[model samples]
Target chain A: MPAGKFTQDELDQIYAFAVDLGRKAGDLLMERVEQRIDGSDAPQTFEEKENAVDIVTQTDEDVEVFIRDAIHTKYPTHKFLGEESYAKGESREYLLDAQPTWCIDPLDGTVNYTHLFPMYCVSIGFVVDNLPVIGVIYAPFQNQLFSACNGRGAWLNEKRRLPLIRNPIPPMPANAPSQCIFSCEWGKDRRDIPDGNMHRKIESFVNMAAEIGGREGKGGMVHGIRSLGSATLDLAYTAMGSFDIWWEGGCWEWDVAAGIAILLEAGGLITSANPPDDFDTASIPDVKLGSRLYLAIRPAGPSATESGRESQERTVREVWRRVRQLSYSRPGA
Target chain B: MPAGKFTQDELDQIYAFAVDLGRKAGDLLMERVEQRIDGSDAPQTFEEKENAVDIVTQTDEDVEVFIRDAIHTKYPTHKFLGEESYAKGESREYLLDAQPTWCIDPLDGTVNYTHLFPMYCVSIGFVVDNLPVIGVIYAPFQNQLFSACNGRGAWLNEKRRLPLIRNPIPPMPANAPSQCIFSCEWGKDRRDIPDGNMHRKIESFVNMAAEIGGREGKGGMVHGIRSLGSATLDLAYTAMGSFDIWWEGGCWEWDVAAGIAILLEAGGLITSANPPDDFDTASIPDVKLGSRLYLAIRPAGPSATESGRESQERTVREVWRRVRQLSYSRPGA
Candidate 1:
């Protein structure tokens, strides 16, 4: 074990705790959903965040409070950062230090929750030295649980090891985008400026979906584009090999931290959503948890000409070239 | 019983048969999926329909053949219309007459099917006098079965009656778009003309997702936009109250006939995806099975000022005005 780091046993314990906590949070969400559906719930109310499209509900707050308390009671010395608490804080600082911190998004799909869309989930990530090491995500409506500990591999329902088809993951095609099932979101930012984040995002989506040789030669014509409205679940699905590519912007650390750990453990790659300065470079930099920009690709199988990492790198570069670069800034950055 | 129509008992029998057939087709699909995932499936091959994005696989054809044969054997006099047969036919006529016909998309969401995305399903619809009277859709991966019989009701797994929250489904808000979870797809038509069908579709999507008071008053600021790549499943979700609205174009009758029957039975409304000639009319024209354009809204809760149908109609008009009218023509139309 590293000098200041927890060993394998401790990490497994943390992963187990987070998985249980995630399921508990998911139960709370299901209860609230039942109340809302059965007409026994309190007054229906939602507080707008960035705009009407971005909203928060009482359930989100309540569940976050419960998760925070549970974590604090179990590990009193660990720092905490959650979506609700961060939104309520006065300072609004972006802080991720060397100490262990639990990143929690009690309800990742708040709008889906309010609308009863059944894609929402609870995401809990334990971060050490600013890197997600233990991740657990539970989608109760689908009864799917995804968790991963660093170097321990990702699992679905603690039963199936992921990439779900791990025996020989298919090698990404030469023209990656043409065969890719891309996952992206129309994020909280709704500005329609000509080349603003929203405009660029939509343009990127169009470029990817448009026919080949169209859009001034920018079209990639991906197999399909899906927006499930929950970053955590999107990454979890990508990890399990259902979705081939996930590109996102304007999401927070709590929204992606757990999914990132799981995805990485499942042999996936995460890079900056934005285009790099040099396309000729062999490697692209990994996106930071708070970068608010990300592009993830599932692990590739054995290829005669290219290794799995090379295939993933080629995909990232090819995709980056097709879609318009997007810019999303943190609240205080 | 009407002179030319099947009696209630006959319709119920047909419904039961369709449900059984749907489950069998779903089982075939699941087996093929397992074979593909485990690397034991036959050599992968897909035939292009209109273009690269539009594809048909061997499994799709095989499932359709199995279903068609079963239907013809049981109901010798009934007509049949299915996606594969239609594509293979030379006439390519848009035919929906007075005859009793079985409309089947043996496998909807073929792209999802090939990609193992789990949103694919088997949709079986029975149409009489150009109206869908019985609907059955089964998603093997999700193990969900949605079915309905005209004048009877829609059901999930033949148990839970839909809107899923039937006690009192929520009424559409005064400003529906601001709070709606809209569903649309980037269909096979991927041209990039400035004001063409694909262009307008993209523009409408942007308008629906943009910030309020933006995009020249076309901004809808909807809570979310989801694309599941499966029209049948989309309509099923909307019928069950998970999605607020669904607008689609370029899909065939086999894609939506079953969903239409289910949605109508669930107390929802369907209108043309294109705008009407007179918005002031008391009732909008119901879209035909072969319209190539459709708009669907979930059933609304009881309201003092307006009935559920009225509320749904209002939402249809509101959404029609927000999205650009797309043009989708059938073969030889």
Candidate 2:
């Protein structure tokens, strides 16, 4: 093996380290949660970034630093990136080189964590030359540990194989619009564009298929739209078929790298939320993990029958079409 | 005790019975889930009532019948009200008389169950006359059992006290609109109303307080909006301070009956989702539990200080105001 370039065996070792590190980090975070629940401390002070909804607490910083130090002690020359320290010196350019980089989100759902919502998680993604090679996501409250290496299949708690591969990859919906559960996250960006703001886009998107006086061919009227306040878990569970569709953006690379590995291994597909009209899957075989825009679909699950596969394809196509109709573009996009 | 009413011992026995029965019912449902994962059965058929979202599968009926028979054999005089049996000459009127009765949702969050959302549960509520006297909710996947008997206090797993109540009764949020976590459910009804529809109302409600760029005061932008798909667990967790405010409607009485008993014991408050402008809490200390529209707020926890008390009151007032602003109404109302 080259001095700087590690083989797949080395990558697997790092993935092991990440799984343990993530579980420990998750324990520290949940300990603080218990503290908050016990009223051991007064209300926490959170520093707002772009908006009130986009805030970070001290635990987030502390957890990130701990993870960074731990990684440094293990791999001195390896680069590390975290959400809290993104701009100090580290940037995407650091990930552009042919070196192993550790992309970590010490806390993916900060808002959910502070509010005592159970959807928060610890996400760590190890990328090689900007390619996500291994991912780990730990949801403490749910006691779920999801991890995947580039080629190895995803696992929940390191036991069961995912997609459980029942009928197909993503579980087919018994029915769409009314019987399917979809996931949507209201990201940190509260900016309003010419097309529509995030809030506006969500309202319109929900109204399109929802029963608005039986509005004809307008609403996706999906069984429901759920926002867990955590992007990593959203992708993780979507990969496991907890949700049929997951549409997310306005977050950075660290938030999704680990999830991307898991989702792909679980047989789910990812595409640009806003794709060109004649989008060719053959050409765009992979989604730009750093572009900050993503639409994910779980491959049909065990419920998907030989007959249902045809309908599932049509539904996936229609959902992709609707994603385009929403026209939600962030300033960065 | 009166002729038709039970003594304290009788109530205790009934509560114990419900808890055990609920756990067993939940187990059966989960076993079926495992069977599906192991590919042991053909696709099950579901019957739709009002719409596709309003569905009931054979398992629901089977579970209801099992519970009903057990209760009937134990206490033949006690009436039973269940979702699967509601249309067969059963109604809240069965619960209106002074006779002891059982109100049950054999499987709550049915849609979640079918889609493997992991938020569904088995809720069994026991009532005397019109009052919710005993409540039990079992989440099989999470292995959580929440139960409460009036004035007996609530227990999770029959061990720990909930809210852990740190400050006072319900923990006060640092800010109502920006720091609180809220729960909202879209029921089975998909009718488009004159002023948009339930789907539109929900979108507006979520966006009104959700973070939107430059929308100013129009958006309530509360910390976030979450939907559990199961009214029972939503109420059970809200009672435990997992959710700050839970606004729900368009479901039946059995859905919220068990939650009502649990929330009241937790020192939480529930009012009509749309309260009259001049509604006086001093005069009407207790909310009408049968109302289809309901809004619940958690009381400060064991840490509730005099200063935190004031903030808790303010946040509750603001959440109530938002509920009224949304103008959510029930078909019965």
Candidate 3:
């Protein structure tokens, strides 16, 4: 499908459908919230083989199944890649080919939901030949809906267009230290491996970020570090410039698929843990899994040439170079 | 002043005064927001000082002066310790004495304010003989007011009591790994640091935490780390049980003064960065300056026996031991 082949009316219909589905999911979540509040349902109850953490509630399964069924029934010709159905040894061919496919994560922050933290969301992305061209993220808790359609620009809550902030980011003084904030999982892998390299890499990254951004050198210290426990929300916050930089490891594609589209559309940059051979859409999948690292910098004004996008890229690369060699091994490995 | 010395009527008046002051300061901030939105006033600007981040805003100074003046004029007998004045060499003796004194950080989380991040607050605490007996923290952006009296429970918005979660925390399994979360400043002190030991400490903490909490560990890994940028709000959130643990260095007493009172009142614990010390009222100070560290933990569940506290204490000690030997030295050092 060529870029201009989709007419404006078709795009509008798709946008409306996506928004409706997002709202439907949010409404279901609200219903669940009411059930929990009314004691009609317990949010989590154990079943055999699945730990409480591993168990997906009926809401999770039902929501995903509903979306998949609805989409497949409505658009039988379209391909689908969803979180719940992907683990049955399905091939990635749909995503590999240049066909239009829907990538959906019914719930982006599941732990938050289990704990009732109110930071979770429903994420949906439309990909053409593996490239995200339409993104919809609905955070029911915050009543925030962020959507973008390639060249149409992004919108918050359908009415408010997200005008990109174009303020000039002051040039970071030469020799000025830089700061970094990274997020990683505390997976259940501690026991089998006594020596943890992830620990070393994190230590190195924090130390270097602080050192470069701290007081002993020409640059001021890095601002600080934060781990919010939700990748989608983290990426969303980063895209809005509430945070300066975000680095991460050990996250799945669903965790970042919709967020990646939003981040890229917002003019933010995303790259692999290691420098990419080329900075383009193709680099996304490689950077999505936990195997690769990601460095995302919020967009800055072009007038501040020295410390603009290029400078930020160089700074990130330098920070990566300083800590890249630190080895990390999984416990069993 | 003894607990019963003040009549119920007098106590009511004091509460009213504190609440009014908080609201007034909040209104001033709201005005600033409107002005910024209307393009009538510029957002607060931030500058880097020697290893420190500084924000110069009329709101901060104005709010501080307004609070101090109102207190002084109304209760001239009461002593006051505030941030802006302290920077100009105010005495710490007032805070040390047993007399009723006020500790205030008119604009907590100034960095958030400068960046329009919506996490800043106005914190006010009342201490009699160094024991924080009253606390009022108001976050205008979120319209949240966290308040508490010595014997009374904490409240948010004067209606909802603290510890919003209704469910009991699950028991800690015997096989549970040692996992923790910490919050700290990336102070403006990077200029003199050469080796980036601070970064190393962060890497070490994150790695250790991840290893202990990550996959392959018997017990699940620690949840994650977060930095909200304001000690007052951080401590308040801890008191609310939103975060299990908090550790911070490079902040002042006013920042944590009110929050400390609220935490203790809520049955949480706090100690200096050194081995776990008593978190009794006597141990808290009125003002803490550069190079101080703190550890705060919300009380564990009924299942946590004396042995459980002891085990948790030992783990914390081990973490500190690893962290203590590490330091980020200035470039020349």
Query: Which has the better lDDT: candidate 1, or candidate 2?
Result: 1
lDDT of 3 by residue, B224-285 (tens): 44566688888887676566566665566678778877877665667655432433223333
Instruction: Identify the leading candidate in terms of TM-score.
Output: 1
Residue A294 in candidate 2, Cα distance off native in Å: 1.4
Per-prediction DockQ: 0.69, 0.46, 0.27
Please give fnat for model 3. 0.27
Q: What is the C-alpha RMSD of each candidate to the true structure, in Å?
A: 2.0, 3.9, 6.2
Model 2 Cα lDDT, one tens digit per residue, B1-333 = 521357878887888889889999999898887876677855546777666677787788888998999999987988988878875553334234556778899999887777777788888988776678788998897788888987678878897576554453444655565666777776665566655447545644654455533344445666667766788888887778768878776566789888888887777777656545754342223555556667777656433354534554555566554454334343322
Instruction: Answer with 1 or 3, whichever has the higher lDDT.
Output: 1
**What lDDT does the true structure give each of the candidates?**
0.87, 0.71, 0.59
lDDT of 3 at A289: 31
- Alpha carbon deviation, residue B91, candidate 3 (Å): 6.6
> Judged by DockQ cut-offs, is candidate 2 incorrect, acceptable, medium or high?
acceptable
Per-candidate TM-scores read 0.96, 0.88, 0.78
Tens digit of lDDT per residue, candidate 3, span A118-180?
Answer: 557888877665566677888785577777776666666776444223333333223322433
Report the C-alpha lDDT of model 2 over A1-333, residue by residue, as the tens digit: 421466768877888898999999999898888777677876656887767777889999999999999999999988988888974453334243457888899999887787666778999988776677788999898788899886678888898677653643434654554456778766655454445546545654555346633545545667767777788988988777778777776677889988988887777777666646764332333567666777777756444354434444445555654554443343322
Sort the candidates on DockQ, descending order: 1, 2, 3
